[model samples]
Target: MTVIVREFQPADAAAAVRVRRAAAPYTVTTPASMVNEHRAAPPARRYLMLVAERDGEVVGYANAGLAYESSEPGQAFATPLVDPAHRGHGVGGALLGTAEEYLAGLGAREVYTWVLDAPECRAFAGARGYRPTRTLRYQRLDLASAALPEPPDVLPPGVELRTAADFAADPRPVYAADVEVTADEPTDIPFGPVDYEEWLADTWNDPLLDRELTAVVLVDGAVAAFSAAHTDGEGRYVSAMTGTLRAHRGRGLATLAKAESLRRARAAGCVEAYTSNDSENGPMLAINRRFGYEPCATEVRHVRTLG
Candidate 1:
């Protein structure tokens, strides 16, 4: 029987999560996030979540969509995966072809995706017209064995520690902090100005965002730095983003926030923590290393321009 690729259905979600996790274990994923992403994507995004089935079993999953939030025109993304148990088949190639065709029809002139750094994965992307651009390092810290720094007995002058939950009644300040930090992140594609409504829908409302586990730092009552926490609800936690406002750089605010977040996560029964950083982002990478995060995997970002 031929492998079949089609739009993901509600019934295919569990299989899709398994397939993606098998192919890419470095990132945090849950069935809820997977389904929420597909449902919450704005219409302008034109997001299409696709899954591949072979012999009546789902073995591949992919998502392709236009970059509606990007001010840069002709930008798009397509990330595809085939389960390790099913890679010998042509599922990956079939998914990519379909994704590219959809993107082309959407008037996207360039396509980007992250491929695992392994030789076979690199070769697969290379043969598919994608050229490597930047490398990202995926790091993991064994919270069970980590020697997390202890919070000081006395608070630093004029500094206060809080959790994202503290601002539940008014998350605008948290959203504002997110916007400022995200804009400064180093990336291949610049995220266009983020919309408040979209941010609320796609990020703040995510089921995995445990506000109580997310550490926030306040400098004189202003949101200065924070580490967003996403949990799998099963002892797996990821620091979605650790960022400090430009004004707060060099003060170790980000490091403080992330450390507190991780310590709290471990105490919350989380056994493992993971995060990714661009190889060139020396500051954040150093912070992770200081926190005992060891490199587990790497991904090479590849881009293909449509003719």
Candidate 2:
């Protein structure tokens, strides 16, 4: 079967989302988010999402870019996803080849990608010069059956629970909180301080992110801890990111924000909630378990070095 890989078009949003869902089921993705990401991609990153077609239908897709935001040099990525039914054909390999060629041309000397923790996936990456590095596990929570925690009626002396909606007028504060939390999360490589403009254009304006569903904890009138949320119109919600500043580490603020956000999600009719955690993050893993989240899938991070 002949497979063709080409730059993604705006009209391919729906098919691209389907391919992603088939390949990485736990991650949050929607047609609108796909379009937003592809359109708002920063020029510095040299970002591209390529789609592979077989028999005139989209069979796979790839996300490729230079990690321009990383403090370290030579970092980049090209993640490919192929529909299960279309696998074993040349689709995946073709898409991956195009992705790597694009990244390498952009001066990338090192590239990273996530492969599902399975024999075939490992062997596939290993055959292509990728080496296994770390593991990440996806967790699932049934919002429909969960006895979610209630929002606290009373607050800790200086803490207040709020929503992202409250900061709509000026989201720089939320952006400040996000960079703090993101800098602390485990990463495949070290990232530089985030670009506020990029965050505003891509993340802040992401269509899937639900401002009211996102729960925030404010301390002394400043954004402290928060849970970011994204939802597909079809009753599926994702715990996009949750974080607390290093100064507020042990205050249980992350837990409080996530709990409140999950409660809000269920109330808003989301039935399936999902999140991923690095295997080494015991603290966050335990916190998620406490919320009755169960392990669903495991993925391994793979890296390849180019000449």
Kindly list the per-residue Cα lDDT of model 2 for residues 1-307, writing each as its tens digit: 7899999998999999999999888887889999999999988988999999998999899999988888888899988899999989988889889999888888899999999998988898999999999999999998999987777788899999999999999999999989988888888899877788999888899999999999999999989899999999889999989989888889999999999999999989999999999998888899999999999999999999986
**Which runs in model 2 stand beyond 4 Å of their true positions?**
none
Per-residue lDDT, model 2, residue 281, is 87
For model 1, the superposed segments whose C-alpha errors exceed 4 Å read none
Residue pairs that clash (backbone atoms under 3 angstroms), model 1? none
lDDT of 1 by residue, 38-118 (tens): 888878889999998898899999999988777789999999999998887899998988999999999999999989998
For candidate 2, the lDDT comes to 0.91
Name the best candidate (by lDDT).
Answer: 2
Worst 10 residues of 2 by lDDT: 146-155
